[model samples]
Target: MSSGAMSQKMTCDKSQDRHEEKVQSSCKQSPPGHMTDLGKEEVADNGRPEKKCVEEVQSLWTTEASGSVKLRIDELCPQEPITVHQMFINCVQKYGHLPALASKRKEKWEKITFSEYYRCCRMAAKSFLKLGLERFHSVAILGFNSEEWFFSAVGAVFAGGLSTGIYTTNSPEACHHVAKDSRANIIVIENQKQLDKILLIKDNLPHLKAIVQYSGSLKKKLPNLYSWEEFMRLGLDIPDKTLDDIISSQKANQCCVLIYTSGTTGAPKGVMLSHDNITWTARHASRAGDMQPAEIKQETIVSYLPLSHIAAQIYDLWTGIQWGELVYFAQPDALKGTLVNTLREATPSSHMGVPRVWEKMMEKIKLEVSRCAYLKKKLVTWAMSVSLEANLKYSKDEEKPFLFNLANSLVLEKLRAELGFSGCQKFFSGAAPIGSDTFEFFLGLNIHLYEAYGMSESSGPHFMSGPYTYRMESCGKVVPGCRCKIANVDADGSGEVCLWGRDVFMGYLNMKDKTVEAFDEEGWLCSGDLGKTDEDGFLYITGRIKELIITAGGENVPPVPIEDAVKRELPFISNAMLIGDKRKFLSMLLTIKCVINVETMEPTDDLSPEAVKFCQQLGSQATKVSDITGGKDKLLNQAIQDGIARVNSKATSNAQRIQKWIVLGKDFSVSGGELGPTMKLRRAAVLKMYHNEVETFYRELKK
Candidate 1:
């Protein structure tokens, strides 16, 4: 079948009354002369299609259980499903000589070809098999992004086991939960620190059979613990056919990966993704993002984001493998401050950053610009205005001003090169809401940081912004072959964004109640995200259903928009969290930008360069957060009040306006439990942590 025909068949046409029936029928039918069950078609040695019994193909999607426990596989299309192993093999066959993974060792960089990567993965798989890894079991990797991490993850799947990633920052108890819940047969750690975490909880993990340390020497040798060298050698004696048979037994519909959500509100739930989910989403999403295949032009990407998150896993690992992109392993301190250094060297063709990452870059650039000579600063200011105007016009499909070229050549191009984004074709921000201030800041630099929206349950991205489909604040259109609907829409057309696609995960692992809650009767995954579609089908996320604050007057207010507005109005503010649930009026908790301790990622009292400059402009000598919070800096206090008033003046209703706010002494940090690993605001956690302060806002009102 042609690709277009397959896409049309797969896409759910919500306008038609028989759309649900069509979806059901598609899942039940077996097209003649086409592969039905196993993901992609099998080819014979003679280059013809290998035939399989229809009965065998039909059994792929079936399971012994009924009700919610049964895997949900709907909207089947004519395109055959492919396994992760098959995808890797296909890429190797086509780009075997191409660089697949690169790592810096000492002062030199080493590259591995696709063929070598596949071979190493097979070795890891054999090692897993030898270590007693069983079918449906998991190999949990706790470490930074590295070549070994990829090999272990892909190898586990090749050995008929699930690949799970434990966040490097997880505490011992949290790590124990993931390890025990997943029934991990083997735990792979990067260094002694992660090894120590596993050791502290190893007694609780009955299913854990082996532990492998991939980096650094073992602190103390113990039973069932092996070094990287020792682990790889254990599988050397295993027969290739032994591992091949296990790989062949794998099916496209079976769960192969377990992604645990970052528990912002509650305990993390393991998200189950099948072979088909990863394979299908990778192919379609790459196309949606206009990712060039290796056959066209091999792409390069620097992988630094937490691989535990679905966003990073899909973009850096699965998608990279799918397109034969060269994946460079960023240093362990990448998030601390070295990511830009890696970017400078790799000169990646594409980059993905969480909102916090982009925000930090913006602050860094702004600080440097603030210190520039008067004439240079003026030139940069003028160039930014020109580029911002041109880009805004371009987004609307309007002609760019003639001076755009001049500005790009003089200032914008150098800025991009300085930041090592000269070759970056696409810049993506996801995993959290990006403030419009940060979005516009990038636009001013001639960089279009497209926003993507999805959760672990949706594989990665259901809606994505690309060059042709982007809007100023919208998260772009639904990916091809996906279906979306806004449920329980309000008068403004905003509602819970429900999604259905090949990318939707099977179900939450061992949580039947949550799995059932995730989907409705029609098998659509309830995204739990409140959003609306524009006339052009672009999705604008208003807020999360869980995060929406209902005032005492019953007025609904989304805090993100309000908080973003306040931050935009006050350039010195680093974080603004709106609080007013069940209260008569709204208030806010604000934090000023301060110097961060790179070693510990803790906030310091010393003001950041930008903050210091802002205070200087206000004719204040305050340098520490304590200096401003002491109530002695009248200029700073008045400036903040003025900014908040300006933000309040634009409020649609009195209930939506912030009545009062307090500037917190310290900024929110992951270690402080005010933010998640992705740097997303933990509203519930924050409120609880500052319960005393929060009550003070309504103390007088209650009396």
Candidate 2:
């Protein structure tokens, strides 16, 4: 068929049929002259839309009339539309002998090739089918980043079911909400701990058919429960043709994965992502990041972040497959400190870290340096100063200093090698805004931490910073082929960031009203983040619209800038939360930097090495949080007041200045319900948790 003929046919299908109307109502129609960049005429043989498959997938999403899903395959995608199965097969065929996944088992790394990885996924898929996984049903995976987690997710998609990952930190009720919401047919868990959570709510999940534990021994055997080995063997007798037929029927436009939001405000909403959303975004995003193809050199990456998050899933699973990158799974206790160990061994080419991860790394490095010998400390400090000056000059397009190379060779390179970053080409930070302190710290070591900005609704990356396009405090340019515009711009040109591309998700699962609110009439995904773009198209996020603090005086203040300023002024501060929404004046809640119990992952009263040094420099003998808070050390108190006064001096207006502040006994943490799984602050939860403290701030002010 000719291009005109295909357009006419699609238009007729949209206008003449009721079902087509329903699909078109929810899906954005291709504008005239919108053509693929393949440089060849699209024909029916070139992966034309399959009506039945498209409708089947569209049925899973809920979208109001105002909302739109991008389903125009020919125009939106540069290459031919392809399913996940096809993408996986192409990767295996090209790099079958290459190492695809590596996992440490009993202190030895076990490697799996692409061919073996494909075989394992098929085995898992057949097992899922044998276990009675119905089409469109979900395979809910609750686990860490492991081979088992990868198998469960890919197998579910291969078996014609949606793969949904539940955060391991979720409580039983939270797990139940996701499982029931997805109508999960099978639950794949890491061990007995996750299984116990499911068992508590198994009776409530009507669609649940089986439970598979991938690690650890089961405490008690149940009829529906099976071990990983046992489950893989269940479908051995199942014919390959059975799974093949399911794969053949799958369409690129169909939903294959469900990523639930962190739900800072309320219950989590399931974000439906199509196969094209995964495959296309993976390919294009990799291109945007300047990732080399497997044909040239296969990149290596460490997978430690939660797979449930879109960023990790895209980078580790989809993008890894696209480029045949070797992915090494970190230990289950990766966040507790084992991550650097894995990074050292893996020597990955690319790595991604959340802000907290980078911050922790910065804190660790500083603490270690503080304990170094006097000469060594001074030498390292001098090298860092040289590197920092050079990098700052480079950022300003000025020539580097003459001693930069010497400093990098003598100290900076050694520091990076110690942190397992010697082989790292690109370092990325996302999921939360990284502080300027952390950014500058890494930059001082000649490490450029690229910042990316996006949401699950945009299939991970909308704006990405790269080596050539990087700018300080900017999220770089929009990903190749993606479109972004600031909506409802204010006087300062900051507004809600809107995105448009194939990367935009289908819609929310079973939430039409919410889905409608997600997109504007022009079919752009309305990112609730407030940001502005520079002349060079680098995006800078200011604050979240929902997180903006509106005072009683009707002044809207972005809390992040103020909070970050406070932390920058007071290096000992761990977290600073600006609170003045609908209140008389702005007040802040702060947490001092302290040691954390690795086992419990909880904050301890004992001050961190850096914090202790800060106190000593201020002529205070404080060693623990109690030493300062209880004893009310005049030096420490005065130091804090002076820091806040400095921050207040820079405020644009009096309304934005924090009037009162108090340090909390404990720091915020994910387990404590003050932060989400990604370490992003849950503002509503924090407010509710500290209601009394906030009330006291205002109450005492009146007194």
Candidate 3:
């Protein structure tokens, strides 16, 4: 949904009687627990060089349930901190002078040291106090991933309040919905653009107390709106001891952040996460990520992913604080273009991307390869085959056959560098399922890409590809502190992948009924995702239980994996929807990629001469990207036949084959309501929106 569609301005400007949770800290702090999880390296009182925190005398006993447990990430680290603020304080004191946060500004990288970051965080917290926000209240963070954003969130934490992030792409109405539900008292916005959104629905948010913006251009227009500087300036009068008192009184179980779910089926729910949730998760994540102790302070990572999601919290915010790692923030709106450039320039030690990022990168590379000269194309193809063959062997725990290393050094290594993974030691994917074909492409490039499985309920990923054991086709082993189990198995062994872990979220904030439904009686988080575990302990997802397509013969078919396979066969097919539930035969709905004029930036509803010739060879007329969906256009239908045939050939029965199919008039888009806010397909919504078109396919099948 576009901001314009919802509203041109933000909503809210009211006061409410807010309840504050104040902890009276009478008990003295323990004689400093064994190790602080806040990325602490003990400083010697006698000038002996510092070490990776203080080593304890406790026995390093291994757990009997090895399968459920993972390698200990940090034994010295505490299991939980009274508050995330305390965790941050421990880290800031240990690495006070180290670079904590950095961002690219005007083509230059700017940084703030841990000390400066702490100061800013303190000031930001004081600003909230200056706004008269009650403790335990929420401060909605509305902005791109930036230094100020992180500072503001941490500041809220210091003031003993919950920090909630709203997606930068959320429409104004969605923003209003979140604000209203979260009961956000103050919103720290990025600029006038976002400020305008709050203005649109301000009247509806009865609890919203103030609007604070980083930009000062609109200071004169809205008298109540305060500039970033002005807001922090208000905090100068707030004694530093005030924030210290708040942080000192924070409890471990208190809600520290409210992370909203993707809401594919309905309205997004606020997932309440406590301080322990993040500190515990980040500790395990620190080890699972395989950050060598030597590289803990030296490593640099880019923060380009959506900050609203749980993944960014673990890797960018919480993890950065835990390890004292340098974080580079990508420019807003220019993330795609500059991310690649910055990767090439900065050469980060670790990198992460979702499926869409890899998918688009592959499309760009393939397009360029198509235009390459015959000899160059042939050489590139042969080189990739060699790497792919080697990767296949390596994945099976076999050594590279012959001249494999030579092939990598000759063609693959340079290519990896070009795509910005040369220096990247840890490249992983999570959030959603990545296509097998896409995974292989990265493997072919010698870029060992791995997949992980988790949700907002798990505090990001409690399971990921560890350094020692990893499989290309499965989500890796359970991270430490998380016990994984497959429940209610079928004949095929597929079942709901369930988990119980310290890293799991506290629960939904306000939805009592939904909270009960999220987990089973045993407290295992019922993921709702259907999958099976292999003998090697690797987990392979079949599909969503709610999304399973039961054919007329009663055979269940997982559509996503099949759709991904079809795309692997034909790159032109943008998306495929397998329609066979309760039907005599299987069918599909596909939407091709959008084609636009390079210069004009308008939809080119005319196919290129070369493109037309390519489709002509497949017995289909040329069609533009815009014409492939939204209506009945058979011009490109035949062109996708080979791809469909490839999928059908793999099917076990006739009911699983694509007996009929059609191209949609548009992409499965978030703004179009075809996909959910998180970009996951809304099956029910999609079907309802195209009921007439979908029914026609079945009617034709009847004939």
Candidate 4:
């Protein structure tokens, strides 16, 4: 699309874009500070932009946005020749003997040095070359997080192929969609299970040339299927110089990874992130959670989040590779079990989790507290109160009471140890908006929970909280080399979060139409999500612009916070969505989180009102999550009502509170088409699926 056509295409969007609409608004628009050449804009700027990393946003947000002459973080910007392959080779030279990777084998963590990691990476790349993979082509990796997964991903990049990953939870049809769309030449899988999925759908994927299993041998051994070791052996004859030649020729603008978005609105779009994106992100992300110099050198991180998620790609993979940080592969199947144990053993210097992960951890802590002795419970309650007070005071930069110091050592320190957070100086939470209460709770325990903001389109970690500038509510100020602006705005300065930077993605793979739609003529990518910048340029993501619930009174209320509040009220709720766009009052659709640990495959403790009622329904026998979620129990129904009431109590007005709610008969899941790959709620899809329920809610209101 030409620049003129792009302008016409984004006409509707510009009106809604607060940054564009209120160009002349006086919001203390300060010029950005000079920075190192690492983050300088590469593309020519036709029209004058706000600054290199500064941007126009809500007037309310920037009325006092300037804070003590903020300067760009030059130290965290990417250096020259920023490519994944180049970066990996550079690390090998700098940290040759440093432990680069660790994967589980039976019961122990097997380690790999930086040089060894590069050698394996080169072997994988050489194998891809042997398979006839080339530049502009793609590779598909299907599996959970593993060392093999990393090797394959880097191998694809080293071989000059655009590498993309498929969520392990994706159905065969979904897998086929991505594989076919990407036109991947080689597809890498973990075991028989993932291989079987490809076999079921490979017939439709003519571009798929070979299948490489990362682990687990198949006796069948189809013509195109090869063991990972066999594939690696194919490149054994290839010299290290050949791999170096490819890495040296690699360009910064080459599409390195195709990260698929969560697809909350529609089908998943493969975001084409270039080598520049990865390196820039890797540099800034390493410094996003700002730790001590010593801590950075010896940083250990437990990698358990799905590597497919952009959060994991940055937090564990890319940053680890770039900074020579030690990464321990935690089992994806053990969020609370093997992962917790591994974190304890590793004592990782850094930790990161999505909202769900942290929420589950908080829930577990509460559950454990409930089971404590009376004396223990009393002491814990007292300590938590004192600690929460101290944390809140500390957040506001106020002097903490001396008692807080005592409480931190006496209770919080031990609590951190038990939860395997003893060495975590800064724990990151992102990929979803976390509740302030949850943040407070984490802070209460003396954990530095840094909320961040990024997407596959931005590589990852574009904006994040850090030790230097901590904010519980906002994600953080614009990252060192990135520009952030609240685009489509209203009278109050809330609208789309437009982004542009070195880390911004190339475009959606094989989707030129979407590519044009993603960015404006000025080169700013209009992020569909709604947010606002604080007085100090910190970002506070409110919700998706499309998901905003505007009531009949014309009041725009973000559903995310309300829905999050509702979910927190009930331990059983897996998801919640507020519905009131042009309606008189808000209503919610509630879905249950199974009373079993899906990851650990263990039944949750038979506590909670839902479990009690479920047991009663089953003639007082112990009941499973499937039973309670499928059937309607009186006690469970009442509990849902009480939970809604609790959420509504926080609403400032009746219009804002949930007036009606229905506990859905089933959970929203990826396979069910009600949730996205990351389990993010597909609000529109859910409303359409439950059209009758929603109508009944409004129909009864009319009657």
Candidate 5:
């Protein structure tokens, strides 16, 4: 189909999105009788017919409206030499009047329309070209999420310079590694803090030619440094038509970005994604997720997540451009206010989040519920349950039971308004392992938070929760058109997840042997993540293969399940490491949250045994995690054993409980360069750092 045909079809689908209307209508009908079967136990146990019940609804979500619309390759002919420049042309022509990028001024969010966004990016790109930046040259972008940071990246891309994105949270040493490794010629940074990080390593990186500072407040004397405004001024000499011609000469296979992996181990490696890689990934994602152009023009996205990450890059920026979506950037400190206000002003139809964001949202709800009157909380809970049941039954068969709808209107509608999610139609959560209970509860609120699963290597999405037909535990069926397989499984069937698809990265830049090793003889890229597919072919990730702990008896144990259990039982505990290779039993090193002293109000050194002792005395708190390892001494043996008897009760014969354990006071932090930005455990480095504590666990036992 032609682009015009695709546009018309998408416009038609926008006319058909009546989910909220259906929900409002359902609120007026009677309750479904079948719902009794779904929530009977909760009603019976609570001795209240109106009590809220938590249940999972299985519904199928499809993009039949948008999916049928197709675009031939001819529709997307490159008008520019590079992807970023081409995107600017797209924004100017298609979505000129729509807000394209946003930033904050005086604690208020300000928006720049698509045309304005294009103009800024073009000016920056032209400036780079004037600076003699050439194809394959590397430019590093460092700082908070800002308009300057984004436009500079577009500028680099327009000049045929590959951008190396570095998280502002990273240390000077980390910055040095990325700069030296990518051989960046120019560094675009936000402010003093970011510039300082670069300056600290400037002597270490001799290839670095210039430091482009965005904040105009930098008045200090520095060598080869340019201000953001000064850089844009240089572009004034370059004509718009000349820059357009430069953009048109760009090739799809040309390296556009040098995205560093959130390194689970060692130094971060640059993953080279070509212009084609990004465009195709965005296209595939848009198609699979039904990210329609009309939705872009209508939806408002609040961008606060680190722009350095691929998730932010693909979902927030690239996808937004394809559809003419408005982008909103929030100040780092005012994320909560910005997110809530943006949601209110934009009343966004679509939103994407991570596990941490969802957990905080739930915590906010709990906090609000705490402040509400008892009767109001009970009414809200009851209404939500009824609404969920009605939705489930109605979805199964479009028959609305009248009684249920009346109960829903009384309570559920109010609950949604309180959550500030009343207008949100579809939500997506990805990047971390989310609790199944939390996942189901959101579904009960009439909001489907599809928990997607994938890594940077997979171009950001491999599996997703079908917006309509979602399974609580499983990440949605392998995203449409992607093929995957399990490589070398153990007896219970879990194994390394391998994938081969159009979306997969070409390979780690300049690491030929490592790239070859990642793929099998047949070319399937081994995902290093351990997982299993249910009989229905739904993929469920358990843990990383390297993070899997094996006992002396060779019984493989995925620590994530156990660690998740430990953390659930103790939210104050930030990090936990289970260690036991050839030892007598599995033991864990717990890191408890540090508390401040009354006198100084300063955190008491937590890296001491006293903190562990204090946490142990707090009591044996426990919460059950599902579909995990089942053993005889399960309940009693599960909680970290304070003594021998408790330890004996928790472990099965072969997995016999933790013999000894120690608690560390300090929590792992990414800013400290201890944990990766993604929060994955760096076991070897962790073990090496705490070698004494680990040794004490076994050494004390030997005594």
Candidate 6:
């Protein structure tokens, strides 16, 4: 059947609503205590409260057995998907006066309300029709976050066209790969830099038609490129309602967004997410998060991450629209400046971040505390301890000790305010493994960061951690309805993680064989990650099965988890590669975090030549400062030596130790070719980069 026809045939029965546990407050009258299933003497086994089962009005939410679990996403949209055009319509109708998006233009913050946002998207769609951007035609967006970028994306979606976004940080080759692969006809690029990258390979993309540029200023000289203003002016004459009607009529199963894999295995694979796919995922996740519509007094969010990734789309755009929230897009380069000010000003109740961002925030916290008096540090530490304990207990649905909470308010409130997270109600961490210590550290500060795990193919979060029942190292319980099992276990029973759920993506776009391989004969997607579940059913992701090492001693070891542990303790460390595929013992190569001193404008000579050479020349003026000594030369020398010593001390033994390592003069990044878009190490690529060093290590061992 034709895709559109197939989508039209797909129908959702209201009886099959996946999220059945939701108690519409409008229909039910109950006290706040009647929310949670706890403290019910006459409660039914099915969790229905006999005496109006009480729900404790928690500031945050988690999907517990007693609470409402989100409905399966597939059930929500059924055959018809939730299109991007629909998101614009929903936001306009529900939150037209609210700021839909905020982006910087010419060093000033620019905002568009939900109504204006819908108008812009509609106009852009109309303009695209005028320009003949039609079904299945690819439009590639390349640049930092901006209102123009967003409008163009929505416009393309409204016109029944596929839209693909590239990270502005990506190199020309990466851009070329996506542009050519997507068969892009029209490209929206940010400024001359991104335009230049596309222009560099413009000749190579045979399908390329037009280059649309948006930025600080448009250069009149660029060839085959239309200026942002000029492009919008053409569409401005088109009525908004015309585009809206066209979008509303579009089928759900139609392609809404095209996301490319980070290419950890090889070249990027395009994953087509329909309006149904994204909308349902967002709906269920919001439900799982217990994001009640009433709780959204005024949703404010910071959208600074790269929009090319799924996390940014699901959380920033999709959730923002569904909940009638305001999204603040920061200037690409001024993330820190914008972040602190935005958080303080907006005081968003919900925020999501990768582990690294939180780590850096903690580092900043430490740096700030170093300047405070010793007594202040002691008080802060004591307060953090109390607050964290309260948070941990609170997560488990246990009441916080009254004394501890009192102590927390008296002491940690100041610390929380200093961190500019005083009003922050909920935070989520995903995309990578976060250490338990780091998790606990935030909880201690009364910042409940709900760490979850999922892949791009899974449509984002599958397992979630919240203020309850979290095992320090385990990712979290499988989000309701998602089932995970281990495959190919040894004597100890560790194996590859396989998952089956509605949140799973339809499949890689146009890659049937590849999709088949990802799933089993029974149709479960093999997550490619190595993990294990506890007796309590909590999921603990150990490592990647693909990156496992089998030592000569017949011991199979997963390296990523071990490497992750060591790296967490050493903040200066950037990347750690575990070596010992068929060797006597395990060893690793550690690279320190590289930083550029804002004042000096050069790589700080913070470590000794030997250690610096070992750590890949990770010199930063952004040191712990407390660890530095005397002057720049002295501090650099000591910092280098200290960074090496820190990593050396964190290793467990010969198997888990860094025997000999070299820090590179550079950092691993997507643009730099050392890291994947998902931030996973390109192992073979890194090994290739350090071939000589590997040879030296083997030779030294033999000697």
* lDDT by residue for model 4 (410-516), tens: 88789999878887777888888787667877877877678888888788877878887677688888877677777767776678899867677766766767877
RMSD of each: 9.3, 9.3, 8.5, 12.9, 14.7, 11.2
Question: Clash number for every model?
Answer: 4, 0, 19, 8, 20, 26
Per-residue lDDT of model 1, residues 1-703, tens digit only:
3332222222212112242233224333432222223343342112212232111233222221111122334454345666787677666656767999988877567777776677778878988999999888899999999988998999999998889999998999999999888889999999999998998999999999999998887889999999887787777677766876777666667788999988897888888888888988887776677777888799999999999999999999999888889999999999788988999999999999999999999998998898899999999999998998888777545767779989989999999998989899899999988888789899899999888989998999989987777888888888877889999999989999999878888777778788788888877899888999988999999999989999999999988888888988898899899999999999999999999999999999999998998999889999999998845689998998999999999999989988888889999998898998889888999999889889998999878
Q: Which consecutive 10 residues in model 6 have the weakest lDDT in total? A: 37-46
lDDT of 1: 0.83
Q: TM-score of model 6 relative to the true fold?
A: 0.78
Residue range 453-514, candidate 3, lDDT tens digits:
88898888867885565887778877755678999999989999997776766667767688
- Give all TM-scores, in the order shown: 0.91, 0.91, 0.85, 0.83, 0.77, 0.78
Candidate 4 residue 486 Cα shift, in angstroms, is 2.0
Worst 10 residues of 5 by lDDT: 60-69
- Model 3 ranges with Cα > 4 A deviation: 1-82, 293-297, 373-375, 396-402, 551-555, 582-584, 596-623, 626-636, 700-703
- Poorest 10 consecutive residues by lDDT, candidate 3: 12-21
Task: State the lDDT of candidate 5 residue by residue for 314-344, as single tens digits.
Answer: 7787777666777776665433444666565
Better of 4 and 5 by lDDT: 4
Order of the predicted models by lDDT, top scorer first: 2, 1, 4, 3, 6, 5
Model 5 residue-pair collision total: 20
lDDT of 6 by residue, 66-93 (tens): 1211223243223223445554444444
